[model samples]
Target chain A: MIRTAFFVSGRTAITAEILGHSLITQFDDVNFRRIVLPFIDTEEKALQAVAQIKAQAEADQCRPVVFSTFISENLRKLFVMDEALTLDFFETFIGPLEKELERQSSHTAGKVHAISNFEEYKHRIDAVNFATTHDDGGMAKNLQDADVILVGVSRSGKTPTCLYLALQYGIKAANYPFTPEDFADHRLPKPLHPFRNKLIGITIEPQRLSQIRQSRKPDSQYAQLSTCEQEVKLAESLMQHERIPFLNTTRLSIEELSTTIMLKAGLKRRCY
Target chain B: MIRTAFFVSGRTAITAEILGHSLITQFDDVNFRRIVLPFIDTEEKALQAVAQIKAQAEADQCRPVVFSTFISENLRKLFVMDEALTLDFFETFIGPLEKELERQSSHTAGKVHAISNFEEYKHRIDAVNFATTHDDGGMAKNLQDADVILVGVSRSGKTPTCLYLALQYGIKAANYPFTPEDFADHRLPKPLHPFRNKLIGITIEPQRLSQIRQSRKPDSQYAQLSTCEQEVKLAESLMQHERIPFLNTTRLSIEELSTTIMLKAGLKRRCY
Candidate 1:
């Protein structure tokens, strides 16, 4: 079955989408087409959103499910429609939170997305620049500034994981690839030796690594399964010999890898 | 006063953190020390998390707030503690969702982080690679493959926005900086002429742009206020003459800029 869902919010609607997605995905039987209504902080915008949702529901011949994070009580009521199912995040949780915390919510609109803390925001932007500059062993002189350095075979999901850590968490992540020369021996790379405590090794299963490499470069020695197996085995052996903690990215998503890396490395997330 | 909060989940606690952070931030009076306990998929791990929360609560002499997305009923019960205020996202929302949809939720654990859609995952990886290669006007010959091209003066928040769009939304974004040469003339650069339809202009206020540039290259002509004003004025005028839709990124976060760019370009997000 196809269902229409609206993720409504007074701000960016990102929180609404995250909460809504986590809930709606549980109903695996229905395919949901999500529409995001962001920046609807006023009564007029709320009314327009209601009309839009009602029209969409009527056109689809189904009651549209709305998941909202609107903070204003008056604006939240405007979204109440007889033809649609509306679930307000703040309404459901805020009262209970107030009781527990012994204070009412500030009820501020769009504060979550504001760049209120310039220092923290600037740190995140600087971290992004750092990750980009140090990506794939691009620069080693500034390795000391990195919060975490990722060591892995090429195409073992290093770049994206580093970037995610940098952008999402304000983590200064740098990555280095194990080349053919490095696989000849068990010694850590000279540049990485000084930052042993910050190193997190990432390895992938040979078959998966081969498939990934094959997509990038077809019919090459670099993409052969035998070469991949040899490199991965040697990489694992080196990491074990050096007592470097490692993760297998064979069956993990980037988010999983980054989160696990943060935990394993004991790195603090500089931003929320 | 400072309070402790735990964002716990069976998978990556990203959703938990997003929801928890959004709610916790509304109470501006109290400072929060946020901790993420992710990959708590087992009963033993859940028990350990509960013990950890209890210990922290006792140490603080205050009850901690626990926000969880544990889909398993058995595991969810393990998190309830007298010393903690628990908010289970799935427990709170899934029942109502099931009742509304007239269906039972799968109640599966950690299904959201699974890389079940390989094609979609691969596309995101490819988009990230594309954005990296084309960052800062590095590559322009393959502009045809770009889903969106961002044009702006240096440090106007183009590279990070492109990377965010690529990693977060699976949009192939390429960025080009408008150099002093481009400012000398009102015409769009030659390479950008072919893909004007895919172009989205980004502008920043002169003072903000000057501040950003000053940090990067102190005491240089590039960082001078007059230079920033001239470049911004020229860029905005040129964009207006070319009828390119633009956004001011001075007050916008990278997430906001990327989302707005996606909307302005009418580009369909290739992945969620």
Candidate 2:
């Protein structure tokens, strides 16, 4: 049975969605139509959300599930409807936290994604700029400053992973593609020699790489299965020869790749 | 008092960090030294995390806070420590969800950010590439295909916002900077005329714009406050004349800005 799951929050609803997704993803057998109701900070907005939830429930002929992170007690109470199953994150944790910490909960909202610290916020933006400048071996001179430089064949999930690292963790991630020239050379690129410690190789299955490249450039020589196999084999061998750690991105998402790279490089996140 | 807060998970621990940040941000008075422990799928890893938490608690002279999203019942038990306040996300929500949904949760891990749907995953990657290629008026001919086009003064947060929209929501976000030439014309850029509905103006406080420009090109005319003010005024006027909705990005993070823009543009997310 398909049910509607509403993720309600006082602010961006990002946290509510994250928490809700974690719970809902467990029930993979059931399909859920996810709806996000952000900035529902008032009783009126809460009432509106309630009505929407009821309407969806009526349409689906079942109770809609609501996962909320509303800190306002009044706003939270408004969502406690008989028409839906309400799971309030703050209500479940805040009171316990208050007692444990020996302090009353402030019960404020919208601080999760706010620019609470300017220095850190700017640091993240700078990281993103750095990644952009250094993408696809651009600005190789700046490789010395990169927290981690990803080496891989083109379309082996380098660009997105670098961007993810920069955007998510404030880590200056530079990625260099393993070109045909580099493959023929049979050695690490000269520029990458000095910063061996900061190098992480990304590898993908030849079949998968061919499929991805085919999507980008259909019927091209680069997208041929044979070409993909040779390039991936060469890239993996070079990484292994250099003793550089690598990850296969065939099954992993960008988030997983970035997180794994951060851990492997022992790189500290500049911002949370 | 300062305390160490460990965000532990069986997978990337990203959700744990998000949920923990949501809860901990409520207590502005307390300082938290946050640490993320991802990929703790094994009992040994959980035990190590428990030890780390204990060490942090002893060092801080108080119990550390542990926010975990481990789906494994065995791994979950290992985190239950006398030296830390353990808050398990799955433990708190799964049983209640089962009761509410009238279905059993699969009790799986690492599916939250997985590429479950290949088509959606490719769509997200394509969006990112589109945002990259069409960034800063690179491909004016491709603007017609864009889901939303962001027009703003340079350094008013056009690049990061576009990138965030692409990476997070899989929205084809192309940005065009209102340059001196456009300001001289006292009108919207000619390229943006065809797709007015796809336009969203990004504006920042003159002071903030100046600061951002100064960081990029210190001591340049573009970094001057007066130049920033003039550019911003002209951009705002053009946007108002063209009836384009705008957002002030001075206080918003990329996530907040992108979310708000998606809402304003009525752009449905292509990925969850």
Candidate 3:
């Protein structure tokens, strides 16, 4: 049995959980207890965490494991005074990082992702706006401004990838769903032709594509496995003909797809 | 005159950039050189990083500020061999964390945000599918399954927030655009009544809303400031009347807004 605790100087729930979830997968049959200590900017609050850990240790007959992202050394030291074990993410990493970056860590809190830089936040909003407007490539007539234009058959992971790129990287990504007409003619969509250099084609296995479309339009010709197979085949040929870099998203997550697209297209991210 | 550098064991670009950007804003005169050393799962790669850091140090005529997130102590020691200053995110923090969790650090790579667990990844995709199918509310018409329903005027940050909740947390979020007809009556549309318990209202400042709408529909009545102001006011009143938890997205970013909604509504995230 294991008792895992999370403590941070700021709202470290997101960061801690991200690491914990991965760790949990590796070790099964472990009892997990998350002791979240947020806003521990002072030594007093830190000692309070010590008390909680001590209490848990007494009850469990063993020391609890603590994962922390606290920015303050003094506050972290208070936790170290307790019987519980610790994983001090900030203190452990900051010194070497100071050397690597040629500067000292600011030891700042709440800057992990949100409310840190207004400029970066605004850039994300603008990217989302751009993505929403240019979605399906029909709403926005201006394709030249896009950082990357994602082309794919309907429901081939274009829209979600575009949204991920916009929300995560703040890149001006626009997605155009290739209709059957475009597939038959063996050409890129009309508006997308000018932005061929920025095009990234996304396709899925025909079986998976059919599964997705079947949920949307059951018993329809559009949802037929044959139609899905045909569209995917044509889209891949179109991408090859145009020399556009494409990825099959059947097994890849959106993060993988977007990162690969970012590398392939060399699209600079505006924000994190 | 400051030449800052970054190094990490895992893919630390996202984490490094988040902290680095905040540090950059604090010190505007510094130069940054990000040297990402991903896949440092072995001792060989870690030594290669030492070589790269040494070259940069000699060329720049100054010791570089090194920020590292390497999870291995043996590999991290290789960097200490180099002339660059160091801040070790992983090594500095892992011992205490091991104590906290009562277990040793796993030192896993390629799992920070992606490819950690396929089940979690699948949940996120399913949430995205649920969100896209349920987007605009009218499209899905199945409100009972939604983890949360977002009601707001057009371009009030509803769609993007829904996507964010879906992609990031794997929460089944759906959004509805409150139309002019709903605004005229100063009430939520009839369709949203059944899912009142799952509703989270999002509104933006009229000025910001107008700005966003203007980009989508230039010089239209929908994009007018007056229209924005009126809709926002009516939406707020309707939220008040219905006792829905609402947020003003003008100052808050999408992440912040969605997080607050998740907390207020007590929605358990399906995935990380």
Candidate 4:
């Protein structure tokens, strides 16, 4: 069994934890013991953490792996000096950035060149705000302001895609629910009727949707396999009649969904 | 006026654009003369992309930066063979991840971990569902289910934090507006009456809030200096009365806010 320790120092411990989790998920078929050294803010604290890990490793008769994301250089250097610690996975933001600057020395125009696409960045922020405010069940009058409307059944990953588009691309995305009532009526949601051209549908494989719903409402009628299939089929049929462009959200992550939506909606990519 | 080019390839073109925008943000100076490359799948297409980037860089008399996320290994090797074009900056996911994994081998357990607190991850997913059902208006009934409830004036970065927690930690976070009505009454939002303990308030420097708000609603009363000051003072005072824990979101990124909220709310860190 290998022993590992994560040394985190930042204004927030949660960031460290999230990063730590992401890192650990990569390892497979290993008996791993883990420890978190949170709030190691000072160089002294970092050195102490190294010493502790070294002593623990010696006691256990195994070298301990130490991963750190501390911003302090002094702390980082102290850990680097420790021979017992076999690894230091520190995420340093400035080093690569500085190298890029030095390489582009002759072409350095100023910060304005760096932010040539500021307007697009601003628009992405606006899009996220628009999507957040114009969510389903709101007043009908607000729907007119939507640039693109997303309609989907529950557990179809609509909300996340909308937020991503808004936060990242600055598109005005509004999502409306395709409920039993809409399916039964063989039409889009009432609020989405006026903006049919801008309407985009999201669908997922019924089994996947069922599994997602099952986690939240196990053994419920709404989460039944048959019910999920029915809703998906009905929603797809309705979308076909309405001539709405749709994307499958089953295999795609939120990032992919947002990108597809932006491309299909003819919205200019803001960030690039 | 040095000319530069960026060769980008990914699963989607928009992702390449967003990444390009992020890279531009990192550089303080430099003029990117043009960006060349296509968004394509398959190794053959990727090699074609490499050839195009090499030719462009040579013509421009500059070593272009090639930025890619997911491309074939054959294409990666092809780019490496060319010394004139600096293909090192290609932002492929695997290279850095592999480096991190190898670096991690000598450390704790030699596993690259996903950084996240797991409980917070579960809570974030719940928060997405909760946020969908309850917006600023439905804060009361949904307050009970929230792992951490955030309340603040507009542009306090409440929604982003809530969404980040939901997406990253799968926490069910709900947010309520500390609107003028709530402030005048010197109480939490009507919906938050029953679950005061779960409530957390977000505060920001009035000036910063005003600046952010001004971007959305320039010259509006809501974005005015005095108006922001009044709203902040009232919101903080009301939070104090309700005995809700609060954090200042002024300088904290979305990552920081979500993490801090997780810690303060006593949610177990899930990923680390």
* Top-DockQ candidate index: 2
After superposing candidate 3 on the true structure, give the runs of residues whose Cα lies further than 4 Å from its correct spot.
Answer: A1-9, A19-64, A72-83, A95-108, A116-119, A178-185, A206-234, B7-55, B68-81, B86-108, B116-119, B178-184, B203-231
Question: Once model 4 is optimally superposed onto the true structure by TM-score, how far is the C-alpha of residue B90 displaced, in angstroms?
Answer: 11
Comparing 3 and 4 by TM-score, which wins? 3
DockQ of 3: 0.31
Task: Give the winner by TM-score.
Answer: 2
lDDT of 2 by residue, B119-166 (tens): 878888999899889988999998988999999999888888888888
lDDT digits (tens) for residues B1-272 of candidate 1: 88999999999998888888888999999899998999998888988999999999999999999999989899999888799999988998998889889999998776666665778789889999999999998888999999999999999989888989988889999999998899787888899999999999999999988888888899999999999999999999999999989999888888778767766777767765
DockQ, all models: 0.74, 0.79, 0.31, 0.26
Write the number of the candidate with greater DockQ, choosing between 1 and 3: 1
- The TM-scores, one per candidate, come to 0.97, 0.98, 0.80, 0.73
lDDT for model 1, on a 0 to 1 scale? 0.89
Q: All models: lDDT?
A: 0.89, 0.89, 0.72, 0.63
Q: Rank the candidates by DockQ, best first.
A: 2, 1, 3, 4
For residues A177-240, could you state the per-residue lDDT of candidate 3 as single tens digits?
8888887878777777677788888988999888777776899898899999998888888889
Steric clash pairs (candidate 2)? none
Local lDDT at A15 for model 2: 87
lDDT tens digits by residue: candidate 4, A1-272: 35454535433443344334433444543345765565576767777877787778677676555555444556666766433443332234335434644653222212111223436544655665777777664445787777788888887877777776765555778888888888887977766767888888999899978877888899998899999999999999999999999989776666567666766776754543
